[model samples]
Target: MTVLILSVFVLVYLGMAIGRFPGLQIDRTGIALLGAVILALAGAIPGEALATAIDYPTLFILLGLMILSAQFELAGFYGWCAVRLAQAALSPVALLALVVAVGGGLSAVLANDVVVFAMTPLLCAGLVARGLDARPYLIALAGAANAGSAATIIGNPQNILIGQLGHLDFWPFLAACAVPAVLAMVCVFATVAFIWRGRLELADASPLPLSPPDLDLWHLKKALLATLVLLVFFATPLPQEEGVLAVAAAMLISRRFASRRMLGLVDWHLLVLFAALFVVTAALARTGLPAAMVATLANSGWAPDRLSVLAPLSLVASNTIGNVPAVLLLMQVWPSPPEGALYALAVLSTLSGNLLLLGSLANLIVVERAAASGVTLGFWEHAKCGVPMTLSSIALAIGWLWAMGHVGW
Candidate 1:
C-alpha cells in the first residue's frame, strides 16, 4: 500500500514538474485531484485520515481572499488602478518603476495572481500606446507582483498556507518580510530597465485597441471599506480566518452587483488544487518516506530551518512543482519551522517564481495577456529579465535575513 501510494505521489508530482501529463490534457490541478481520487478509491487514505489531511483553515482563508479580490475586480477597482497608473506622465523608465511599484504594492494586500491578471492587459495596451515594447513592462509587472506578495500573509496562496499552518502573527510577518520585498521590487525595476534600456520604447509602435474597464464609485467605496475593516482585524486579536470571512461576506452581498457575479470570479479550481494536494501530501507522509528523508537530512547536518540549507531547496522545489504545491509538500516535514526560516521560505519561494516563464502563474498570466494584445513575451525574453531578477532578489532576501539576525530580530 505504501509503495502504491508513493508511486501515485511520484507520478502526480512528475506531472506537476512537467506542468501536465504527457499524451494527456490534464492540468496540474486535474492531475492532483485525480491522484487524490485514485488513492481514496484504492484505500490508500482512510476516511478519517482524509479529513485531517485537508487543511480547512488554510483553504477557508484562501477562499475568502479570492472572494475579496473578486469584489475588487467586479467593482472595477483593480482596472481603475491600472488605468490610473497608465495615465501617469512619467517617461518609459519612470513608467516601468510605477508598474513595479503599483503591481507589487497591490499584490502585498490582494491575491498576487489576481493582481497580475487585472493589471497585465492595461500595462500591455498602455505601453503599446506609448510606442514602448510590452516585454519589459510585462516582466516587471509579473516579477513585482510575485515579490511584493511575499510581504504579507494574504498576498498569495502559498503565503496564506504558511501563515495559517505556522500560526504566524500578521504584523510581525509583514515587518520581517516587507524590507526584502521592497528591495526585490527595486531589483526588478533595475534589472528590467538595464536589460531593455535602448529598446524600452519603440517610436513607431502603433497602439492596440483596448476597451477601458468600467468604474463605479459606489461599489469601489464599499470594497475599499471592507478591505480597511479586514486590515484593522488583522491588527486585532481576532482569528485571521474570521476576519477574512467577515469581510468576504460583506463583499459578496452588494446592492448593485449580483452575488453570483462576484462569487463567480473566485478561483474554485485553485481551491480544488489545494485540497487535493493536501490529501496527496498527507498520504505521502503516512508512508514514512518524508520522515526518512528528514532523518537523512538531519544526519547530513542539513536543516530546513537554516537559511543556507533551505533557500536552495525552496528555490528548486518552488520552480519545479510551482511555489504553492512546493510549500505544501515541505510543510509536512518542517513542522513548527522557525520564524526567520518561515519568512525566508515564504519570500524565497516567491522570489524564485521570477526565474522562468513557467516559474509562477503570475508570469504565465502576464505573458498570455500580452500575447492577446499582439505583444509576445517569449520564454527567453522573460528569462532575460527573470533570471537576473530572481538571483538578485534571493540574494537580497538572504542578506536581509542575516542582518535581521544580527540586530536580534
Candidate 2:
C-alpha cells in the first residue's frame, strides 16, 4: 500500500511537472485525478477520509473568484481598463509604468490570468497603434501580474491555496505581502522600460487597428457592487470562502450572463486538481514516511518551519514544477509551519515565477496571446526583463519582509 501510494503520487506529480505523459492526452488535472482514483481503488484512502483530505474552502474560494472574473470578462471591464490605460497622455516610460500599475493592481483583486487575457490584445494593439513596440509592455504585463498577485491571498491560485490551507486572514495577509508586492511591481516596470527604452518609442503604426471590447455597463456595475460588498465582508469577521461564495451566488443570479455559462468559465479543472492533490497527499502522509523524512531533514536545516530554508526552497521548487505543485508538495511534508514561514513561502513562490516565461500561468497566457495576435515575443525578449525582474523583485520582497520583521534568514 505504501509503495502503491508513493508510486501513484510520483507519477502524478511527474505528469504535473511535464504537463503531460509522453504519448497520453492527459493533462496535469487528469493526472492528479488518476492518482486519487488509484489510491481509492487500492484502499489507500477510505470513504470518510477522502472528504477530509480535500480542502473545500480553498476550492470554493478559487471557484468563486473565477466566476467573479468571468462576469467581469463578459462585461468587458478589463478591456475597458486596458484601453483606457493605453490612451493615457503619458510618455512611453510613464505609460509602461501605468500599464504595469493597472495589470499588477487588478491582479491583486482579480485572477491575473483573466486580467492578462483581456488586457494583452488591447494593450498590444493600443501600443502598437502608436508605433511603440509591444514586447516590453508584454513582458511587464506578465511580470507585474505575477508580482501583484502576491499582494493578497486571493490574487492567484497558489496564494489562494496557501491562504486557505494556512487559515490566513484577508487583512493580515495583505499587510504581510503588500510591501514586497509593491516593490516587485516597481522593479518589473524599471527593468522592462529601461532595457527596452529605445524600442518603446515609435516602431511602425499597427497595420491593423483594433478596438477594445464593448463594455456591458450594467453587468459591470453589478460585478463592481458585488466585489465591493465582498471586500467589505473580507474586512469584517466573515470567512473568505463564505463571503466569496455569496458574491459568486449573487453574480450568478444575474439575467445578463447565464448561470451555466458563468460556471463553465470557472476553472473546475484546477479545483479538481487541488482536490486530487489533497487526497493523494493525505494518502502519502498516512505512510509515516513523510513525517520521518521531514524530521531527518529538519536537523539538516531544510525544514519548512525555518524561514531561511523555505524561502529559497520555495523559489527553486516553484520555478521547477510550477508554484501550485510546489506548494502542494510542501503541504504534504511540512507539518505545522509557522505563519511567517507560510507567508514567505506563498509570496516567494508566486514572485519567483517572474524568472521565466513558462514560470507562471499569467506569463504563459500573455505570451501565447501575443503570439496568436502576430507579435513575436520570443524567449530572449522575455528573459531580458524576466531574469532581472525575478532577482530584483525577490530581493525587494525579502528585504521588505525582513524590515517588517516577518521572517528572515
lDDT of 1 by residue, 231-339 (tens): 8877677888888888888887767789888778888889999999999999988888898888788789786877778778878887888988899989876656777
Candidate 2 ranges beyond 4 A from true positions: 205-208
Each candidate: how many clashes?
0, 0
Stretches of candidate 1 exceeding 4 Å from the true structure: 202-214, 406-409
Tell me the TM-score of model 1.
Answer: 0.96
Task: TM-score each candidate.
Answer: 0.96, 0.95
State candidate 2's TM-score: 0.95
**Could you give candidate 2's per-residue lDDT for residues 1-409 as a string of tens digits?**
8889889988988887788899889988899999999898889999899989888888888888999999998898888887777677677889899988999999999988889987888887777677777888899988999899999888999998888777777889999999899999999999997888677775554343656678998999899988898788667777778989999988998766789888877778778888999998899999999999998998887777655776677777766678888898787678888888778887899998888776787888898888887888887888888888898888888887777777757
Give me the overall lDDT of model 1. 0.86
Q: Can you give the lDDT of residue 288 in candidate 1? A: 85
Cα misplacement distance, residue 312 of candidate 1 (Å): 1.0
